[model samples]
Target: MNLFTKYLHSVTLSLSKGIQKIACLLLLSIPLFTQAEDGYKLWLRYDKITDKAQQSYYAPRLKTVYADLSDPSVKVAADELQLAVKSLLGFTPVVKAAGTGSQGLTLTIDPKTEGINEEGFSVSTTPKGIHIKARSGAGVLYGVFNLLKNIQTGADPNVTSSPEIQRRLLNHWDNHNGTIERGYAGMSLWKWYELPERIDPRYIDYARANASIGINGTVLNNVNASARFLTHEYLGKVKALADAFRPYGIRVYLSVNFAAPRILGKLKDADPLNPEVQKWWADKTKEIYDLIPDFGGYLVKANSEGEPGPMDYGRTHADGANMLAAAVKPYNGIIMWRAFVYAPDPKGDRFKAAYEEFKPFDGKFADNVILQVKNGPIDFMPREPVSPLFSAMEKTPVSLEFQVTQEYLGWATHWVYLAPMFEEVLKTDTHVKGSGSTLSGILKGDTFGYKMTAMAGVANTGSDRNWTGHPMTQANWYTLGRLAWDTRLTSESIADEWIRQTLTRNNAAVETIRKSMMKTREIYVNYTSPFGLHHVMGEGHHFGPEPWLDKAARPDWTAVYYHRVDSTGIGFNRTATGSNALAQYPGGLVEVYQDEATCPEPFLLWFHHVRWDRPMKSGLSFWNDFVKHFYEGARQVQDLQAEWQSVKAQVPPEIFNNVEARLQTQYKEAVWWRDACVLYFQTHSKMPVPAPYKAPERTLEEVKKLVDIYHIR
Candidate 1:
């Protein structure tokens, strides 16, 4: 018999009969060779390297590992490296404690490191092995993950990196009742019914995934929060999750109800200025910090969308936020007050609501309060201008909030990569200081010299076997974490890295997939809301085409309210003549956008209404150009399908099948969007469909009927 089989047989023979059965069952549970590709491992999947040259190169370097295990975070890092080495190099490394080794990796926590921040890490290589030095245990953990990523991508290991933002977080809009608002992946990850007593193994896996990508914080509940989360019963459950995640360096945060004083304490009225109300919040915050010592703090979505806030008591948002900030200050916690507020204005621009509301009270907030603003002015539309608040708020620290969930990008069914969108917004010159002052620079605190900086993504993860329903959507989650850690990373580079680690390492297949992924966001934009058309989806579901939607409970929620399509032309006049939202931008951008000819074509419809017969840069009229983009977008989906087929042999069968099926749905929906929008807008423009492309097979009326069916409960 082979040596492994002989050893196993002898070991089993030594065990008692019951112990032998248990050992056999344990052995059977773990595959002796390889695990199935079910996508649960995410980007950390350390599959055995099939490339002989790479194996030969990495095997020697991972012969031994030495790391200080005094810190729990560093212990997890050592364990992770050991696991990865065994899976990738085919043998477990000799793990030594608190000492240097002759070969393999060495992780050290050096508080006196010259350039590394608390959460940053530096990796250097020598003939003996690689060394990862960091200022904190969290940094060592981050360094370990980065080193593994470099090995997986076949990149150089000698690199020094730090997170540009102070806090990188994921805001989970998961309700207490196990429902996730706009979560398309599946049910909520937190099993509220069985927490504190029974800790699900999935919680550890979730923490591992987040830590691998450098996400340090997570908000546990929806921004439309329930006060029960602050109750003693729920605090115990939250404390249990915090304990499980602490080893991975992830701090748990909570989304709090602003009126918890009145709702839970049975106070007569909840007012920020009231001493009784302030004391209630102080007591609640103390109770929370006591349970979870490292609690990240609270995310407040108040005075917006009918939620209770100090505004209800005729007090300002600052009055409310500062009170909470003071309550958490003793525990070193910060308050993330959301600036996603908008009043029901039939004539006003929804894009200007947030800026106007918060800009006036810029310097009034407490030191620990961070005004969280969405990437765009309006809700997370497929395409939107960077919010004016990024430039307007000069005194208070502001954090960029991006929606990693595909709420407005066809939910989870459509294949849309959002890294490009995030990159575009980050790189756009806000002109806050001068010509080179980009949003990324502002967010990094380089341009503004702000006290704190952060980036929060509305999380898309759920309880699906694959965290995100669409297997490819996991890239969005990875992109957010990487960008949050370092805003300077290009979307192209992130896509390439993710494709190599998660999908395929084959160079040709990686390139094919990368190219396809890079084009998906723009392709989705073209078919759905090209040329800066925002909020055109169906009312509640936000799925199919709804460019024709003229009625809703609120005017701002309707598609026509923003588009402003008329017999003369189509587009919102945000310049001086209309909402004057352009004036809110810096003088340079205002001048650029005020004129129809100078404005970028992508935002042409967003800023000014132009004649349908106006000549476009492509030498085609506006209407003809619009029709071309619609057709081209639909055509691109077909091209993506063909490209995906080319890489079938490289991707796993389950992943390939999942993506292939999603592509079919995306293609069908793209066609529906193209046909429905072109036909519906034609009614206003009084123009026929441009030549070279035939009309849709289905009529506008027929398309409307289909959309109605989608809106059904």
Candidate 2:
């Protein structure tokens, strides 16, 4: 009741409130000190929005989520929405059972939605709230991710999406020992030593990222498969991964060693026609299905690079594929038979081998068998015409196999946006059926009628903190997934969307990054292997430059076998006078490619062996033009450095610095490629270094030594 007592009570309460406010501020500041952009989040960074108006708009609309948890995928969709809303809008959304007339986002499986495929979804803004509807749980997961993506990029949510191909998968060339075959991004993501029990949280994130872009399947092992993956022990490990990925709708597939019956089962011979061998595979398939019921099936790389196959037993590819297809067919599974076969003949053209082998058996493969052909006739070269097999196999359902690992694109050091390269191959006119017979059209079953369709990318992911070794290479993985979902997406638009979600959202920064990415692949090709000049990479590792490699296990594996450079001219002669590889294509393209004058300049060298002094359409001599590309490619990388430097202030310091360091490495490597290729090739051409470009400071011997130091054969 006294004035002094009342004043003391008021002071005590005021001090307590002030102390509580200070403690809360300290707790909030802890994240600022602890959190840093390390690229581990990838493009799904759901950090709180800094933009006040956008945050306000999203916060209220995403206050609640109505989803049916009975379906595991719908529960996953709900969980993702809650996490994203909490991170992006600073509050977790209350989740309710589906069919509730609540003013919140709705996740429902509406099979009646028109034009929506089994794995496709539609998102629309309703009067009550945003509605995401799909025919399946897989589609609901995809729709939820797309809805979140729209919120981040300020995109319209009223959209429907269906994958262009039925099977969009990532082929991981991971060995049982955790090493990736051509992987530059650290070690493999699968910790084989610890799997089957201790599942890495990264596996879940991996599935989430793939699901966001609509990748429905994954081949977990390398094409040069170890028979161990099929063993009961490894199947448990694979089942663990499959379980982690199942909620995201990603089914796990295996690349089986064809000699598993002999190697793993201790059979006398792994003959496809043998009853014992067939029964062995059937038992294995049943065992696998028992462990993982949704197993996607088998991806076989048989009779290539000394791998065992039906050919080993005097049988055909169809026999090998059909034998395995029969086992999986009982479970409605399919087989992806790789068409990357090459003969060991010293004098044969590697380009003609696949067509020669598979063309005859085009219609002989089992109905469940799909021929997985590389984008180019040769391996995943920097530039080559679309594979003849795409047009050659009319009766077989062919799937386009693309390598997103950047084995030839300077590994992880150099920046090369592969969307343009993928778009280029997909858009190439195959001329099989008509003018509009594109490679994409064929894979979509538009050009060739097929019961199934698929497109696969060799994954570039690894255990690195960034997932991909180089930050920019992550975009390639993103691009492959996006293009697989819808081949019609432009490379530019995909780059824009990725930049906004992953990097700085500033319009200027996005434009600069986009422009840099657009020119990245061309610059890489120019420096490494310009104008359809394929292979020529270091022998075993396929890194750096080795245009003069003449010695290898097989002649076809040698760089000299491909470039065929001599004192008089350069390039392979694939026309009628040479290997006659041009005949493999349709008549319309064959006529154009047979003659050097009519051939597209990019592919001129691929089809013709032009004289050193041949005049080019650029008004420069062939040798001079070739030299110009190498020099200009290196120069463009310098420009990329300058462009990146200008945007340093706009991007996060961690990401900006990471990319800036790589750009520096890229420039040095570009110069190394330019100097090495030009100096070595000049020996055969006997041409002077053209004007406006200085001769390389290092001699050919010095560059050779550099290759030795890098341990590149």
Candidate 3:
């Protein structure tokens, strides 16, 4: 075996022995779990260069990488390489002088120095043995992450990669108080006050994680932002974060409260057209740039959900976006204007809301402005059809914003792997530019051929010592990064990589988890929200079932609005009889959705109301199939729990215990979901429960009471 392999085996053996000794006395009653460090370490699990076999890896080649270190980004990349190499490869890589005389595994940045494309990287091992080149320091850092990934995945470290897109960012729905808006992973990791001064050591590891995954930017707060982040006091703190992230090639952006010019500054009104307001914003932007020269620009949630906007000031959405775009123009920054607006009226189609608000000003946005559209029109629900906005505005640059945090997909408690969901959306044909015009193709600027492009994910990271709360949930983050870099990659490939890196390189173990993960999203959909029955969660906190809830201020916020379950049957009538939102898509897709027969079965409930006795493609009556789905879903969870059991011997006891504990919860929740959903829907179907599926243990009132107790937390 290679030295790295031998070193890892030795360390693992000693570690396992230590654990065995600790648990020896208690062995009869309990199995000790694996070390907590296994999870906190994430996928960057590197080992020492023990045996002489892998000398070529460490030796003189990685001994010293010569970098001029002229640029801050360059210096950051070099320092990160040194740290990762030491911790993982068991050798501290030294940095020598840049350019002219550097030798062996040399990382070269600076266009004038190497002339590589701004987003491209090259790593070649020749007779002389090592040369790593990138267009910029950011590119070099990406290269380092790629190299670390190879070591972790057991791939040849000698390779080259060039990012297809210019920017890959993570959007945090984190508020000033540390509560992630829809976060299930504890509170936000960013302790705003302690920043710049206190510098939580977690910041470095956070940087390391993002750098390894090629995520180059972060918007620190929620789109529904608080004005406090704009003040001079907070800017200092933000600057400290910027400094910390510099080396990792991750730029920091602030989600601006649209009223900042008036609230933070003394402007009379934050009007996009007002001269003083414009000047106020420009000055603030300049100040932000001064502190963080690479400040990535503003992400705005204006005129949406009560957030102040250009509309409040008697201007259009484009006027609002373009105003900020103008402010950051001098600094080469861009604006991410959100297209998630709606007036919250039940009468209007919420599906058509974003398109209506954004379409009129499609070509009006400044070149630097990008409309950040969610994967679907509504909040991230399971199995949503691709957003209609993809084809609505052909002119503006659009960045696909997805949620990796599982806001609607059972949060951190349920084991729902989401790579399949991502792959499904990425491969969706928008038909914007014609046949095969995938969302990925469109966002890359090739479909409409625009310049700036990006893909963002609402971050799942928090203060959890495990990074993501559940051990397996880390796969979601891993999938997002890989897909952002290359939209065409399958969820299986990404999960496989994460499996090998985070858990084990043992092919059997990897294959088992990979199979489980690949089927996770589908299994979740089958049990919880089959056929697109969404927003059924108990109101606030979105925990458990509450399809009976309909008295909320807005219909969109109520469960009944989305599912439309009533005595006659279930599902919303989004066809021509209902919202007719299908008209928003291009001709071909509109036709498919308009006709009940052609509409995909997965979305059958989303578009049409059907009778309980209706026949389905699955060769069962609708009620039989529906009842079976609930039972099948619960069984899948139970089966998964069983599957997780068989592999206990293959994993560290700590990790095994952590996941096993979650699977227990998952099993209970799955039953809760199945029982409650089938019981309630059976009342609407006016049909008896399937022969195999027994009636729920309790009444609807009891289920509602349970929901109340569940969400009250």
Candidate 4:
């Protein structure tokens, strides 16, 4: 029997036990449903569908489930769905182990008996109820999850819905030491210590959640990869995790340590141009694929932040990417070469670095290589202008990399919803291929008709009881997958969908949460670092504001470097007089961003620094407008807080309490941010408070003292 057969057998056995457990408890009460439970199952609540019409319509028609019940996990999916339906809808279907036997709800294998692909699944409505079809049992599992999702979304599950994107992936920046960089939840999910010896049940649920979101790929290790994972020992451990994810349409990827030839193979130089180095990589690539045939290839972060790469050999990014591309080409895998590289060796404007580097190598990449660029230039800042590189690289197949983890956006402390921020960047016109140019259009390859496109979210998940530390933060992960599948999706639409599913089905509660979520990012930008004021956070941890310091080794490392706050004015000067960074644009984007009058108010401070007395195009002086925005942004959060309070009764107190507590945190931090920023800048601007606005309660020295106190100074 193949892998699917074994999985099906395991599922059959698990079902028999669950059914037996239910039979014995037939006289007992409804699911001794515990008050406290680990949120390992994610949003697949599997709650009993209490609606009589839904139960009646779905229960009987979903009677006899069918799939090529060969795989144990596929069988588990079949059994689990059957069990959930039986328990919730009060009806259980007699499942056909295999084949489309003249029956109700046939989730049959497409070819009936043959090899099946990992990531494809199709669901159709049978006259009975549903027919989940796929080439592989894992695909069947994906179909089951899709079917369940429709039911949860209040949509009729007895319909067809397929994914628009071929690849939906999660790039886990997890380290080998099990430390996830910028991870807010807890420890890494891959317990490398217990891995090859023991498999955790949470692994199944991890795959299940991704499958639900149509996510089909995961890069296992951190991009700052360690050489140990490339060894045979770790490959075995990876194989086990790969085995678990394989059943849910997810193919495992690794962040390959670039210096492997030198570190692992004892080579003198790890140059991409060297034949000996090339041979070693090809052999290593073959070794990895041999261990896990369905591996999804590599993610490299070379020549950035001190990581070694083809740049060391004096070659371009194409040389590095194509070298790896050549290594994995035989296996039909692709290389995701990150476009995050910058000469951190200088204090020069880091915002201008990516565009300077990658624009030179526009059409130099291999067909299978996708250059993954961040949504913004300087990490994931709160109010950053959409990355100029998004519009600059016309000939490259680019995948916009977005951070789902709240690394800089309040880490796990603040409730900052991110869909609106994503919408702003995706919808931004780069003008790379003329006026209608957008980040989405660039990714779709219409500008130059590139080979491929992808969007990856740095996963926020960890070993926390609630997947993300903040309960409502799951919306970030959900929003990413939704948008990746359809870039045209509106932030409000994604927020509403997530609110309905994650928070409540109640329209009032949904609307209230949606309203808060849509404005959450902007509100955050307003009170925290409004109007293109980027990188104002404390160094390394980036938890709080610290724009005054300038002691960092590199200019880019200091928030003061990006903000360029001076007695004259504030904000980085990327125009002709300063960095002349505007020349990077292909067309009139330079014109659009050059003058503060034409620049969008949100990004005005990002591109150009003006004096406190300089009148804004809005007719208000710079100082007056800046303070007004901070105050206005704070008031919006207050508005959101009041809106949430009104619909408190619609949601469960357990969930509501979690969010209410966070909003309280958000409100407090908003005040802290507003006070700290306005007070600090006022010292430089020497401006009085704009009339009708409140002055700071504490001094700038006071805020700095609080930060110093937190650092245990």
Task: Encode model 4's per-residue lDDT on 1-713: one tens digit a residue.
Answer: 55654554555555677775764455243344456433444576666676677776777667777655677657767776876667556677787766665546776555453333444566666556567767666566666876776765567564344444556789998887888998989999889999888899888878777777778889998999898999989999999999887777689999987889999999998889999999999999999899889898999999988888888989888898999999999998899998887776454777788888888888888888888889888898886767777776667778889999998898887888888888888888777767888778777666667767688999999888778888878888888877776788898877766665555677777777787777778787887787788888887778777777677756677777778787778888888888877777766678889987688777877889877777776799888988988888778877877887888877666767776787787777777778888888888888888889979878888988867777722
RMSD to the hidden true structure, all candidates: 4.6, 5.1, 5.9, 7.2
Model 4 superposed RMSD (Cα): 7.2
lDDT of 1 by residue, 123-162 (tens): 9988768889999999999999998998889888888998
lDDT of 4: 0.78
lDDT of 2 by residue, 512-539 (tens): 9999999999999899887789899888
Question: Where does model 3 exceed 4 Å of error?
Answer: 1-35, 48-66, 69-90, 93-95, 98-103, 110-116, 156-158, 711-713
The per-prediction tally of clashing pairs is 0, 0, 7, 10
Cα-based lDDT at residue 152, candidate 2? 79
Candidate 2: where is the Cα deviation over 4 Å? Answer: 1-33, 50-53
TM-score of 1: 0.95
Clashing pairs in 2: none
Q: Per-residue lDDT tens digits of candidate 3, residues 1-713? A: 55654454455556567775655434434423435554887877665444464555546667777776876666777777787678766778778777534346677775753434575677766544467678787777777667667665666777666666667889998888888888887899999868778889888888888877878899999998999999999999999999998878889999999998889887889999999989999999999999999999999999987899999968999888988999999999999999989988877768789988888887999999999999987778888888988877788889999998877887888888888998999898877766788888888878888799999999888878888898889988888888887787788889988887788767788888889888788888888888777778777677776677888868788887788777777877877788888778887777667777777888888788876777889889888998888889888988888878877877767788889998888878888888888878777777888787778888877876786576454
TM-scores for every predicted model:
0.95, 0.95, 0.91, 0.89
**Residue 332, model 2: Cα distance from true site in angstroms:** 0.8
Model 1, position 509, has a per-residue lDDT of: 98
Off by over 4 Å in 4: 1-38, 71-77, 97-103, 109-127, 133-141, 156-162, 345-347, 615-619
lDDT of each: 0.90, 0.90, 0.81, 0.78
